[model samples]
Target: MPKLEPEIADEAPCSAEFTAYDEEHLVTYLRLLDAETDGADWREVARIVLRLDPAVDPDGARRCWESHLKRAKWMSGYGYRYFLKKPRGS
Candidate 1:
Protein backbone atom coordinates (compact mmCIF):
# COMPACT_ATOMS: atom_id res chain seq x y z
CA MET A 1 0.00 0.00 0.00
CA PRO A 2 1.15 3.52 -0.69
CA LYS A 3 1.70 5.82 2.26
CA LEU A 4 0.12 9.22 2.40
CA GLU A 5 2.55 12.08 2.69
CA PRO A 6 1.73 14.66 5.29
CA GLU A 7 2.53 18.32 4.96
CA ILE A 8 5.83 19.14 6.63
CA ALA A 9 6.70 22.05 8.81
CA ASP A 10 9.84 24.13 8.46
CA GLU A 11 11.00 22.54 11.68
CA ALA A 12 9.71 19.67 13.75
CA PRO A 13 8.44 20.27 17.26
CA CYS A 14 11.06 20.00 20.01
CA SER A 15 9.40 18.95 23.20
CA ALA A 16 10.50 16.80 26.10
CA GLU A 17 7.24 14.89 25.73
CA PHE A 18 6.10 13.17 22.55
CA THR A 19 3.83 15.50 20.62
CA ALA A 20 0.69 15.21 18.52
CA TYR A 21 2.82 16.19 15.58
CA ASP A 22 5.06 13.27 16.38
CA GLU A 23 2.12 10.92 16.36
CA GLU A 24 0.96 12.22 13.01
CA HIS A 25 4.41 11.90 11.46
CA LEU A 26 5.35 8.48 12.78
CA VAL A 27 5.73 7.01 9.30
CA THR A 28 7.87 9.92 8.26
CA TYR A 29 10.18 9.36 11.22
CA LEU A 30 10.45 5.69 10.41
CA ARG A 31 11.26 6.46 6.80
CA LEU A 32 13.94 8.90 7.90
CA LEU A 33 15.47 6.26 10.13
CA ASP A 34 15.34 3.68 7.36
CA ALA A 35 16.94 6.08 4.96
CA GLU A 36 19.73 6.75 7.43
CA THR A 37 20.24 3.04 7.92
CA ASP A 38 20.40 2.55 4.15
CA GLY A 39 23.08 5.22 3.84
CA ALA A 40 20.89 7.46 1.71
CA ASP A 41 22.13 10.97 0.99
CA TRP A 42 20.52 13.78 2.92
CA ARG A 43 19.74 15.62 -0.28
CA GLU A 44 17.90 12.64 -1.70
CA VAL A 45 16.06 12.04 1.55
CA ALA A 46 15.08 15.69 1.69
CA ARG A 47 13.69 15.63 -1.83
CA ILE A 48 12.08 12.21 -1.77
CA VAL A 49 10.90 11.69 1.80
CA LEU A 50 10.58 15.28 2.90
CA ARG A 51 9.18 16.61 -0.40
CA LEU A 52 11.60 19.52 -0.20
CA ASP A 53 13.88 20.42 -3.08
CA PRO A 54 17.35 21.20 -1.75
CA ALA A 55 18.39 22.84 -5.01
CA VAL A 56 15.57 25.38 -4.80
CA ASP A 57 15.76 26.05 -1.07
CA PRO A 58 18.97 24.64 0.33
CA ASP A 59 18.87 26.26 3.75
CA GLY A 60 15.19 25.58 4.33
CA ALA A 61 15.51 22.00 3.17
CA ARG A 62 18.60 21.42 5.29
CA ARG A 63 16.93 22.89 8.37
CA CYS A 64 13.83 20.80 7.85
CA TRP A 65 15.84 17.66 7.27
CA GLU A 66 18.10 18.21 10.28
CA SER A 67 15.29 19.07 12.67
CA HIS A 68 13.10 16.17 11.56
CA LEU A 69 16.03 13.72 11.61
CA LYS A 70 16.89 14.83 15.13
CA ARG A 71 13.30 14.36 16.19
CA ALA A 72 13.21 11.00 14.42
CA LYS A 73 16.26 9.83 16.38
CA TRP A 74 14.66 11.02 19.59
CA MET A 75 11.51 9.11 18.68
CA SER A 76 13.45 5.91 18.10
CA GLY A 77 15.50 6.31 21.27
CA TYR A 78 13.12 7.61 23.94
CA GLY A 79 9.72 8.47 22.46
CA TYR A 80 8.74 4.89 21.68
CA ARG A 81 8.26 4.50 25.43
CA TYR A 82 5.45 6.99 25.23
CA PHE A 83 3.57 4.79 22.79
CA LEU A 84 4.14 1.74 24.90
CA LYS A 85 2.72 3.49 27.93
CA LYS A 86 -0.17 5.17 26.20
CA PRO A 87 -3.61 3.78 27.00
CA ARG A 88 -5.35 2.06 24.12
CA GLY A 89 -7.85 4.07 22.07
CA SER A 90 -7.39 7.38 23.77
Candidate 2:
Protein backbone atom coordinates (compact mmCIF):
# COMPACT_ATOMS: atom_id res chain seq x y z
CA MET A 1 0.00 0.00 0.00
CA PRO A 2 1.13 3.58 -0.78
CA LYS A 3 0.35 6.69 1.19
CA LEU A 4 -1.53 9.37 -0.66
CA GLU A 5 -1.08 13.11 -0.14
CA PRO A 6 -2.46 16.34 -1.53
CA GLU A 7 -0.33 17.71 -4.32
CA ILE A 8 1.29 21.04 -3.70
CA ALA A 9 2.93 23.29 -6.21
CA ASP A 10 5.49 26.03 -6.05
CA GLU A 11 4.08 29.45 -6.84
CA ALA A 12 5.20 33.02 -7.07
CA PRO A 13 6.05 34.56 -3.74
CA CYS A 14 4.53 37.75 -2.50
CA SER A 15 6.77 40.76 -2.01
CA ALA A 16 6.24 43.44 0.60
CA GLU A 17 5.81 46.98 -0.61
CA PHE A 18 7.51 49.85 1.14
CA THR A 19 4.89 52.57 1.45
CA ALA A 20 6.82 54.84 3.81
CA TYR A 21 4.25 54.15 6.55
CA ASP A 22 6.40 55.58 9.34
CA GLU A 23 7.50 58.71 7.51
CA GLU A 24 3.90 59.65 6.80
CA HIS A 25 1.95 58.54 9.84
CA LEU A 26 -1.57 59.91 10.06
CA VAL A 27 -1.87 62.67 12.63
CA THR A 28 -5.64 62.39 12.62
CA TYR A 29 -7.20 59.73 14.82
CA LEU A 30 -10.42 57.99 13.92
CA ARG A 31 -12.83 55.22 15.09
CA LEU A 32 -16.06 53.42 14.30
CA LEU A 33 -19.11 52.56 16.44
CA ASP A 34 -20.04 48.92 16.97
CA ALA A 35 -23.77 48.96 17.60
CA GLU A 36 -24.16 45.29 16.80
CA THR A 37 -22.34 43.72 19.72
CA ASP A 38 -20.38 46.40 21.48
CA GLY A 39 -20.37 50.15 21.88
CA ALA A 40 -16.96 49.62 20.36
CA ASP A 41 -13.89 48.40 22.13
CA TRP A 42 -12.07 51.60 21.44
CA ARG A 43 -9.38 50.84 23.96
CA GLU A 44 -7.88 48.04 21.87
CA VAL A 45 -7.79 50.12 18.73
CA ALA A 46 -6.31 53.00 20.68
CA ARG A 47 -3.46 50.93 22.00
CA ILE A 48 -2.58 49.96 18.44
CA VAL A 49 -2.66 53.57 17.32
CA LEU A 50 -0.43 54.57 20.21
CA ARG A 51 2.39 52.64 18.57
CA LEU A 52 2.93 55.83 16.64
CA ASP A 53 3.27 57.79 19.85
CA PRO A 54 3.65 56.18 23.25
CA ALA A 55 2.89 59.56 24.71
CA VAL A 56 -0.57 59.49 23.17
CA ASP A 57 -3.30 59.55 25.80
CA PRO A 58 -5.26 56.28 25.85
CA ASP A 59 -8.55 58.08 26.52
CA GLY A 60 -7.94 60.28 23.52
CA ALA A 61 -7.05 57.27 21.40
CA ARG A 62 -10.32 55.58 22.41
CA ARG A 63 -12.19 58.62 21.20
CA CYS A 64 -10.40 58.49 17.92
CA TRP A 65 -10.90 54.75 17.50
CA GLU A 66 -14.60 55.21 18.11
CA SER A 67 -14.84 57.80 15.39
CA HIS A 68 -12.99 55.65 12.92
CA LEU A 69 -14.92 52.48 13.64
CA LYS A 70 -18.20 54.26 13.14
CA ARG A 71 -17.45 54.05 9.45
CA ALA A 72 -16.57 50.35 9.57
CA LYS A 73 -19.33 48.00 8.42
CA TRP A 74 -18.29 45.16 10.68
CA MET A 75 -18.19 47.49 13.64
CA SER A 76 -21.95 47.83 13.49
CA GLY A 77 -22.45 44.06 13.86
CA TYR A 78 -19.85 42.83 16.30
CA GLY A 79 -18.80 42.92 19.94
CA TYR A 80 -15.67 44.04 21.74
CA ARG A 81 -13.76 40.91 20.76
CA TYR A 82 -14.94 40.94 17.16
CA PHE A 83 -12.33 41.04 14.46
CA LEU A 84 -12.82 40.83 10.71
CA LYS A 85 -11.35 37.77 9.08
CA LYS A 86 -9.60 38.11 5.74
CA PRO A 87 -7.46 36.33 3.14
CA ARG A 88 -9.62 33.30 3.78
CA GLY A 89 -12.15 35.95 4.76
CA SER A 90 -13.69 33.72 7.41
TM-score for all models, in order of appearance? 0.92, 0.28
Residue 34 in model 2: lDDT: 24
Q: Give the runs in model 2 whose Cα sits over 4 Å from its true position.
A: 1-41, 49-55, 74-90
Alpha-carbon shift of residue 64 in model 2 (angstroms): 0.8
lDDT of 1 by residue, 17-58 (tens): 987788878999999999999999999999999999999999
Residue 24's lDDT within candidate 2 is: 26
Tell me the lDDT of model 2 at 16.
31
* lDDT (10s digit) by residue, model 2, range 27-73: 21112222224453445544443332224665555544444444233
Cα lDDT listed for each candidate: 0.91, 0.30
- Model 1 has an lDDT value of 0.91
Off by over 4 Å in 1: 1-3
